[model samples]
Target: MTKRPPALVAIVIYKTFSALLLVVMAIALGLTVKKHQLLVDFSESYALEGKLQIIKWTLKEILNLNPKTLQFTSMAVGLYAIVTAIEGIGLWYQKAWAKILVLVLVGISIPPEIFELIRRMSLLKLAVFLVNLAVFWYLLRHSLSTRDDNQLQ
Candidate 1:
């Protein structure tokens, strides 16, 4: 077993979350397929008569009994999952291209996140910006160091 790279940790974590998203999307797709059978009975089977009933409400909202939208959403999530899995595996192996790929993705997201913060400041937005900043900086430094090492050889 090889030791994990410190800088790749965040990317790995993100990719892992995307993998979980893939699972959730798959479930949603299945429920959409069986919407008529399962969703109609959602309240009967999963509802509660309490404050946490919000959870049930949310479940119903997400499982909105719309198979078409769910199918489209699931396909998008599946594509994201495939990309994330590749990035995750590549980063795990410390591949140069993975670092570049992550750099580009995170770089592109930064401006949008910044724009979002400008629109509405929140802890979540701040955290996302900071994490992306750190990853971008780490990859930049790593690339420079690797380049220097190559030149010295």
Candidate 2:
């Protein structure tokens, strides 16, 4: 097998990390269904009562969600996690489909990211958008370079 590029390796690592976080989020959301008090206790334990606005907001939103909604969200998050893991694995193996998949997904997400940034400028959102943009650019460049190399051979 040919050696993988450093940028591809970095992207794979990012995907893996994202997948792991999504899996944890899915499990947490699933467990919290119909457990509003437990979530409150968790927030208290973490001293998130009024410390972080984002954390408080997130907990409030989650608490407001019905059990059924939470279940559905959990399933969706889990599915996304699975997809992300697959992307990372495929990229690690240098699969063309994975490159295309990441490119398309990242490309699709850029618009919403821009809208979100426009609605509310936040450091985290900006960082995420920038990182995703970089990932897309690098993957596109890599794909083009590989195609050109193939044509030359």
Candidate 3:
């Protein structure tokens, strides 16, 4: 097997990490369903005393979410996590379809990212947009180069 390019490896790692985080988030959201009081108690115990008011306010807002909404969010996040995992695995194996999949998904997300940035500019949002843009560019260039190489062969 040919050695994988470093950029591709980096992208795979990013995807894997993202997938793991999403999975954790999905599980946490799922578990939060019908557990408002438990979450409140836990937050109260663990949260800093000085920041109790803020913590309480945040907890209250979260606890107010509908159970069904949490369930649906969990399922959506879990599904996206699965897809991300698949993308990582496929990319690690240098699958063409994986490149295309990532390209399409990233391309689709750029608009919403731009909208968010326009709505409220923040360092974090800017950083995410830049990173995603870099990834998209690299993948597109790599994909085209790979296609050319295949054609020549």
Candidate 4:
């Protein structure tokens, strides 16, 4: 007889994959910040005597900010990414709360998914939406099954 994979194993696999991706994204973002800083340093050096407005615009574009607002936005984005990556890693460990958290988190994303579907209609993004839907479906089914089993016992 062939054996089927356990539901928890599926959850772990999904969570771990997402966690790793988030980690890689976080690292990439960190590298971007470093590169932006290097650009700012170079601009401040010999380029100060050149076209000031163009340099200012270039730096603002690189850092994704205006002159008045500081680069705190980039830091906020990096921190958010790190926090979510940690949450994904936690879910991979099959903590009970993490399961519920993931469910709620994915649930919250559905509205934005709908907006994206309406606006751009990108297939790759649609595929990601579908995958997230499948994950939530599986989690709901698993939770219901567990509840039913407990009631029967």
Question: Which candidate wins on TM-score?
Answer: 3
Q: Give candidate 2's error at residue 138 in angstroms.
A: 0.6
Clashing pairs for model 2 are: none
Q: Residue 48, candidate 1: how far off, in angstroms?
A: 5.9
Q: Which regions of candidate 4 deviate over 4 angstroms?
A: 1-7, 37-94
Q: What TM-score does structure 2 among the candidates reach? A: 0.85
TM-score ranking, high to low? 3, 2, 1, 4
RMSD of each: 3.4, 3.3, 2.6, 6.3
Q: What residue pairs are clashing in model 4? A: none
Per residue, candidate 2 scores C-alpha lDDT tens digits across 92-135 of: 99999999999999999999999999999999999999999999
Could you tally the backbone clashes for each prediction?
0, 0, 0, 0
Error of 1 at 10 (Å): 4.9
Q: Candidate 3: TM-score?
A: 0.87
On lDDT, the leading prediction is 2
Lowest-lDDT window of 10 residues in candidate 1?
42-51
Candidates' C-alpha lDDT: 0.78, 0.92, 0.89, 0.67
Model 4, residue 82: what's the lDDT?
A: 65
| Candidate with the larger lDDT of 1 and 2 | 2
What shift in Å separates residue 55 of candidate 2 from its native position after superposition? 6.5
lDDT of 4 by residue, 27-138 (tens): 6555656576676677667666656687678665766644223335445555655655655666556555766777887788888998999999988889879878887887
